[model samples]
Target chain A: MEELMDILQEFEPGVDFEHCTDLIDGKILNSLEILSLVAEIEDVFDITIPTVEIVPDNFNSAQAMWNMICRLQEEE
Target chain B: MTSYCSFPFLFLFLPAVIVVYQLMPEKKRPYVLLAASYLFFWLISGTLLVFLLFTTVSIYSIGKRLDREGEKRDALLKTAPRDEKKAIRQLCQKKQRRWLALGIFLQLGILLTIKYSGFFVENMNQLLKWQQIEPLIKVPQFVMPIGISFYTLQAFSYLTDVYRGVTKAEPKLSRLALYMSFFPGLMEGPICRYRDMAEQLSAGGKITYHQLTYGVQRILYGMIKKVVIADRLNPLVQELFDSGTAYDGGLMFVALFAFTCQEYMEFSGTMDVVIGTAQIFGIKMQENFERPFFSRTISEFWRRWHITLGTWFKDYIFYPVSMAGPMKKLTKNTRKSLGSYYSPLLAGTVALFCVWSLNGLWHGAGWNYIGFGMFHFMLIVLGNFVEPPVAWAAEKIGLNRDSVPWRIFQMLRTAFLVGMGEVIFRASSLHQGVQMLKTMLTSFTLGSVKNGTLFTLGIDRHDFLITGVALFLVLAVSILQERGIKIRDYIAGRKTPVRWMIYYSAVLFVVVFGAYGNGYLPIDPIYAGF
Candidate 1:
């Protein structure tokens, strides 16, 4: 979770994560950014992400993504 | 008749469909929409309805299959041994790529055959004749089914997302098909993505009283923008731009500016209609525009204007090229050899080239469009190159990027830059674009400005008066939006009297000043050509 926050910070320098609900909703993060984030998450958690679970809802909110990562790890 | 202007569809067909749609059972609504969409296409292109159906079904099935295959591949990756997993992953990736390529090629092939075949055939014939070979190809004449390019691109984007595993393939074929053929987004898009529209498609929510009122108001705003402002500015622009031999320096400059305004109103106004129509259907499409003219930078202008298409390219084209393959290699090598100082600029230039070339091709099979794209690309790239130096000088001189006056100055500068690009874009040809640019740059006679040639472009004093008022109306709406007071939200809060008054005025202004009735040759929606 700390690592994900660090990744988000790297993408958006000086952006406050608390105010980023709209940023995620607006799809301001392009697909490549999403891919990079997914790569980071995969590496950190060491879980294989199933393709079916990669939809917007899974990644649209920081909380949702945290939940997804937790769930993926629990299943593993 | 243009689909928007068709009497039967607007007055008879649409109203009947809306009522029937609301009354239908929730499960039956998709069927109702599907039937209506098919009927709508039939009205326009009769048997070209088959092509539309073919496109929808192929994409829908392909999307579902890709999703399933992707899942299967992932499962295989999980279960396979480590050494085998690597090969399996590669194989799965290859399979996915092939499926995606097939889907894209099928969609793009349909689009090209329908849209560009005649152009290609004619050009090929010309080349062959020049080579002293008998012309083997004949230009086939086909009335391109309305919305083919728009819907096809929408389908392609949806499938691509599914392939990328970013969006799920919509399960129901009917829902997927309806999304593609949804009338509002069909012609020109804030190109609907599956994830955005999927819930809207399945939920057969009955229209509320407020939704109806809001929809009507939205439609009225679109009508006023299109009919009053865009259509009014059309002839003046056409006469000036195509009237090549008529006027000299200053009149030509005004003409160029006129073209800029005309293109904006037409395109954005048409989008207002598209978005409003989607609103009526209880689907919220992405806003393709913000008050683009107010952008303080060229890059910012593109971000705000035709935002969906721009973002689509940035995601699907620019980012991939920038972060992968030859360009990525170049960036890494450059950084290693010469430090990181120039790497971003080099990458930006390459990415911009890809984006602009694709942007130009997306417009049409035309050299002029390519020129238009490259022209803006050069301007934007130049803007980026100069930014650091300009910021440094400003800092040295104590100018601030944050100051209100400086922001206003930058906004005006960006607007002028955009207007210049519009001149090149809206010109008849590359030669005309060059001529217009050269004249605008070199010829600065005060006498030319004082002359009546500016007024002679078919629009009279009355037209100019109406245009001025319309411009104010647009500016006022834009200012409200700029201040973060969304028009819809404000209107939603307004008293009924005030709201109704606004609605009535929109309708009245459109009816009174609109150039569509008699003397106007209906200016086709510009993006329709794409």
Candidate 2:
């Protein structure tokens, strides 16, 4: 979870990823930024984020993203 | 069948379907909808209903096969060793891909051949002529089956979803057909995903008094939008756009703004009617618009307008392209040098390019549509590219990006940019669009608008007055919606006399002022052609 927050911070410098649940819904991270975040998370965590998992529910918050990464890891 | 506003559709066909639907047994209501949808398809496209049938069968069968492969893979995974599980999964994945590929080819092949064959052949012939060879290929003209473009995308989405395990394979054929051919969505669409409409189909809820009245109210609102505003703007828009007269800058700007207004009122109005019709049947359809004019940026504008199509491109094309293996590599390679902000852009721009090119072509087999797509593509890319600088400049100047004044300025700027794209969309050709923009920019004189220039097009001051009033009514409604106040609920809560009076007044307003009767040169529901 801390690792996920760190990655979100790198993509959007000042966003409160720790508290911002609307990161996806509020358009804080637009599509391209989401792409960058996805790639970085995959590298740091060693998990593949499939296109199906790229929905708002999985990326709307740091916790949501952490949940998705954990799930992908479990699947692997 | 001419349009939703046509007497036959409003008076005869729709009411008949509703009556029959209500009379049918609860469990059988969905089938009644299926029959009515097929009948509507038959009325418009005749034997071409076969195309819809073909796709319905294709998705059902392929989906089941994909599901079977999933089952086989899961079963094997439970028994196999960890190392062997990977191999088993790959083997099943190969089979699923083959089936999915076949489904895509079969579906898109028909759309490509019927919709784009003429454009391809004509362009090819021109290429051949340029090479000093006699052009010999004849362009084939095919009448596109109504809703083919819309349903094909829905069909594609369903198949892709099943393959991705986003949605399960729909075992029933009728339910799938109803999804593809729902009469309200048949001609143009909000492009429902199977999951979105699946529950509504199976539920077959009864149309209550509230649903009926509210549904009619929604339909009436749509009627006013289409007839009072869009239809009234039609001739003036057509003349300004298609008439070869080189009008002054005032008229050109009118042409620019007028077509955008007409397209919005017509398309969104159609959605109102479609959604309202769904409401009458106690099935809630997704909204295709959300006050697009209120948007503060080109990207935000697309998210609001023709919303389903925009999201369709985003989900199916944009994300896939961005996440494709090549793009993944591109993003990784760029990150080290360009840093976080700029790295993903290189890959994203590629995805945007594909989306826009296909989006433009999807509207029609014309270069102007492609230009319209690229026009927006450039705007969005430029917006992304300049964001950091713009933010820096804003902070330096003490401008609040989220303040009312700043937001208004952004909205107006976005509207101006969107209006120009509308001109390109409505132009006869890409060359014409460029010429119109050139003339609009170069020949500026506001005095021409006041000198009786407006009266000469096709409509008079009376027509202008009615459209203005109608537009304001829509604007008031939009403003309320944007503020999160539901006008329908407000009206619904009013006293019976007040509600009925408002309802009667609305009906009379449409009946008395609508631009429909004879001599009105059949108002084409604009997006239906696309």
Candidate 3:
């Protein structure tokens, strides 16, 4: 989780990714930020996220994103 | 059959549809609507109704198959051992993916074959001639079925939404078909999403007095905009845009601005009719325009204008393409090489390119249309690039970026950008667009207007005055709406006499000033062709 926060901060500094559950829905994490976050998550966790998995429900919060990473990793 | 704004549609078709629709049982109202919608499509598209039916059947079948596969997968995953679950899910996904791909390919294939084959063939033949090879391919002429671009996108959205588990496949094929061919939106659309519209379409309701009055008022309001403003500007726009070299730069600029206004009024006016017509049926379609001219940026303007199409592209195309594996990898590599600020923009830029290119091509299969897309793309990209530096500079200069004057300045700048793009859009060809631009830059003179050169165009001075008054009324209403005052609701709150006075006057204005009858040719809804 610390590692995830670090990656999130590195991608978009000053954003409280740990708390902002509406990151995607609120437009806090825009399309570009989401792309950057996805790239970082994939590299950090070594999981290939299918395109369908890249939805707001899966990436709107840090916890949601972390859960998706874990699930994809376990599948792999 | 004329457009929705025509007397025939207002007096004949719509009244007939409404009376029939109202008399039907609530459950069977959808069938009435479906029949009316098909008749509407058939009237406009003639034999091209086959294409709409083909789309409806194909998408419905694909959606059902996808739903079935999804259900089977979920059921199996529930019973399978934890260790085998991932494999089973993947297998199911792979199969479902093929179906989704097939659905998309077939729809896009049909769209491209009918809409773009001539352009493709012509360009290919041009290339062949350029390379000193014999140009053999003859461009095939096809009368594209009306609203194919719109309905296809709506259908594609449904299929993809179901596949992504965003929404379940609509079980009833008739319901899905009605959603696809909903008459109000069948021609030019606000482009309803399945999730937004499907249930509303299926659940028919009795029209309340409020719905009926509000719907008629809205339709009348749209008619005023279409007839009083847009249609009046048509001949001048045609004259100026067509004969670019013959006009002075001042007139050219006037023509360009006129075209912009004409397009907005016509397109948004048509949307008002569509949304209002839907409202009378107690089915509230999404709004397409929200006073786009009031936007402070090209991007914001896009958000306000043709709003659904923009959202559709953003949701379906931009998001997917940006988050795809290749784009993710590209973002990573760019971040490593070019640093953070620049790298974040890379994925967005690529996705934007796709969106804009498709957006431009979606408008029409012409170079000018593509140029229209590229024009906005370049502006947006440039805006993104310079934003930080511009912000820093503004801060350094103690400029209040949020001040009213600055906001107004930004709005004008955005309008100027949009106007230039519209110039390209309105031009007969790209070469003509360039010529228009050149003439505008070179031959500009304010004296032309003072010397009554404007009168030499189609509209007389008295006609101009009427158009001016109508435009001002529109502008005033737009301002009020922009400030969060609901003009319709406010009027609805008044006493019956006052409300009736407003309604009667509105009707009177449209009747007196409308550009119809003997001399004027009806301007088809501009976006309907697309």
Q: Considering every candidate listed, which one attains the maximal TM-score?
A: 2
Candidate 1 Cα RMSD (Å)? 3.9
Residue-level lDDT of model 3, residues B306-424, one tens digit each, is 98999889888887888777777788888888766677688889999999999999999999999999999999889878888999999999999999999999999898789889999
TM-score of each: 0.88, 0.97, 0.94
What are the TM values for chain B, all candidates?
0.93, 0.98, 0.98
Candidate 1: clashing pairs of residues: none
Q: How do the candidates rank by lDDT, highest first?
A: 2, 3, 1
Per-residue lDDT of candidate 2, residues B328-428 (tens digit): 88998888898888889999999999999999999999999999999999999999999999999999999899999989999999999999999999899
Give a tens-digit lDDT track for model 1, residues B252-347.
Answer: 678767877787887788787777666666778899998998998888899889999887777577766665546555655565464333554576
- Over 4 Å off in model 3, which ranges? A1-29, A40-49, A53-76, B336-340
Candidate 2: stretches off by over 4 Å:
A9-28
